[model samples]
Target: MPAVTADTLTLPRIAPPAPAAQQRPVRSVTTAPSGYEGEGFPVRRAFAGVSTADLDPFIHMDQMGEVEYAPGEPKGTPWHPHRGFETVTYIIDGIFEHQDSHGGGGEITDGDTQWMTAGSGILHIEKPPEHLVVSGGLFHGIQLWVNLPSANKFNPPRYQDIRGRQASLLSSDDGGALLRVIAGEVGEHKGPGSTFTPITLVHATISPGAQLRVPWRPDFNALAYVLAGNATVGTEARPVRKGQLALFGPGDALTLAAGTSQPAAEPNLEVLLLGGRPIREPVVQYGPFVMNTREEIMQALKDFQSGSFGVIPGERIPHT
Candidate 1:
């Protein structure tokens, strides 16, 4: 959706916004640099969208990792297993179940989005939903991991259930700007963001001095994360407040305005953009496990002490 002339503010370098429907198209776009930063319990700022250092073939990006149980704490997230990768969750509030062994089970809340494809293997878990378990005020959400281009890496397991009315809402019917298409497509208003990778997820809102110009795919690889009341991404005008995170340079597009501490009753501003098409493999890590070289990460810790990456389902929160 590109074509605006008012208030002056623009962007353009995008190119991949026109291929949606269970998604599976491709080209290029690289920018999965998020070095990891987790904050659970009373903590909620997972990776802030990591800037790549450890988990390279794309191995983790948690935007919200809050799991505060407190009263009888015993919170959860165990029963794990993954291989070559791809895991994404986008809930905006509480609720859970999300079981897995590849059998697949689900339940996401508030704006729902779950796309698991632990290719080559599986065994997952996500707790806190025994009917709200004990609830919290803002369990919010965001989770990502993608990498499986060793020629599909071993393609096997799969799962995708992105609900929110099948995604796709780039406002401006006359209501200012409000795009919320969780994956690819941002033009003809046809998006349901499904991706094995080659991704694109958008959630933009512009008003109060409005300026939203979107259109690009020049080569993929873009970035923008402002999540609250401040804006300005790429094309260098600088000033991307509200948790700062911007990395754009492919032809540059996405220029938002209205700031100065920005106030006017807040005007609803939240932004999050993602990329796809970057399998530049060869990575290895020790925390939360990520593999591909370094002797396959010492054979994944010798296959997790020979038990073979099993048993981490409820108690053993070790592995720091």
Candidate 2:
């Protein structure tokens, strides 16, 4: 105590605050996948049993073809019109080509993503590339429909394409977990995709025993869909498996851990986390068109028939 020098002082280590108490607890509602036939291929829909009212903003979500496409067997959604909503397509494998009536066309290969905003109206086709259709390998992807608010329902149509590495990536402290921000922010990292409504979409991959904490806006409705493997989510540590959707309760943050409470032969966990501010407006959906009222839906169909929804390049107009 004679002289308070730097060498004579001992610094005490202060541990970081516990995060669990401040984080939101996860309450999971498990939903099963329903088999459905799309235009040319089969699909397993995870949002069929759940109502759009419950999901809000996110009206539909479909997991496309984990099925093998033999040569000359690969098929895709033909020309279709959409309005008052946005479609987000994330590729997990193979290749998919998309062409819109506005002359916006491109190919999204493995790990690519396409976000199409069909504000007023737009016609588009999404299918496998010609090479895949001929030499057909495995094809798989996920398409999610996000509903627009009443104000932006009639905005101009637009598109955003994000390559695999274009998205923001965040790794865990131990480097066992990775999160790819698709339309939201994780810490200081922001996603590449632009969103009209306040929403967050993230794709995360976690190794066995790794835990990832995701910060979410308290006012946003949040849910997580497990694409592959298994995960224990939230403070309650609810178990969610592959091909299943897990809906969460109110919380500022979500805690997701790979595998179950009991250790086994657990594989890597791949999940998509989506959250958006609830749009309480009325929602009327007809086929591919989604609007706030039935009258709007009818007008969307009329526009499509009148050739106002844009035209696909080189597409022939069928004679009546």
Candidate 3:
């Protein structure tokens, strides 16, 4: 395996959003809608395994609609193939074992991270460990789809495993906010994710009455998904609460300040900031399938039907 270069990636300097780019970099704001709505936990499914919805350049985001596996249930997705883009799976309160045809496999638990670049083509499958699920508790997480630039649409696949403890934390010294860099840098702390796409993913935690500033990428689209408490984004000072998606228009920076702070005198406020240059490609998808042109979609269908996409991730293991 090639030596892992600087696994931590920092954001580029935020240039002023041009007059044309002065608009919110975000192209759209969308809710997950829903998921498979399975039982309490313990489940197995493909990318379609969860209730997935797309927000423009971001092809799909199965946030809470994502299901989990109870201790010792059938909780692993079979084999699947992805072309033309990348898949980033984040775990907020669970554990996962990801294995792909590119000869990459690892575990991501709690604050840890895993990013898979499914360039050109590759068969991949991810799931919680049998022991962890059987004797383990519930499995919960969020998966995001990022469209690859046209130039890298067919590059060989790659993967990165970032441990939660290893990630750099950028928090204000004066009880303001904590920016957990998962994919890119916020302020100064760089995250432990490596990718070719122009993107930033942060797990931001804001305190009561605390306002933090994050340089905004003028060219890249951006939005914040409130996971915990309430905060505001951009100059309009729009409020963003848990389960709500805050889409940003042209803005040079993002301002997040706390509200009532809720109970305990300091309610936890969290949000995921994600956005990139829009792919603007024609998307056609059907259960574990995402393709650009309709014709390409048809070809993908044919490949899967004929098993031309290659074998399952661990199918070569030949179990006794």
Question: In each prediction, how many residue pairs overlap at the backbone (N, C-alpha, C within less than 3 A)?
Answer: 18, 0, 11
Error of 2 at 305 (Å): 1.9
Residue-wise C-alpha lDDT for candidate 3, range 1-320, written one tens digit per residue: 00111212242332333444343433333443443522333322222322223345676665532334445663556667787777887777666677777776677766666788877677887766666766756455667777776677667888887777666666544546666677766545567788677678877666678776667666666677766667766656676665667666665566666775554622767677886766666667765556666787777678767776556654333211
Candidate 2 wrongly placed segments (more than 4 Å):
1-22, 260-266, 315-320
Q: What TM-score, computed on C-alpha atoms, does each candidate reach?
A: 0.32, 0.87, 0.77
TM-score of 1: 0.32
Which stretches in model 1 have alpha-carbon errors above 4 Å? 1-81, 88-122, 129-132, 136-139, 143-145, 151-207, 212-217, 221-252, 255-267, 278-309, 313-320
Best by lDDT: 2
Q: What's the lDDT for all of these models?
A: 0.56, 0.77, 0.62
The TM-score, computed over Cα atoms with residue i paired to residue i, of candidate 2 is 0.87
Model 1 backbone overlap count: 18
Which ranges in model 3 have alpha carbons more than 4 Å from their true place?
1-31, 37-56, 64-70, 73-76, 187-189, 263-266, 313-320
lDDT of 1: 0.56
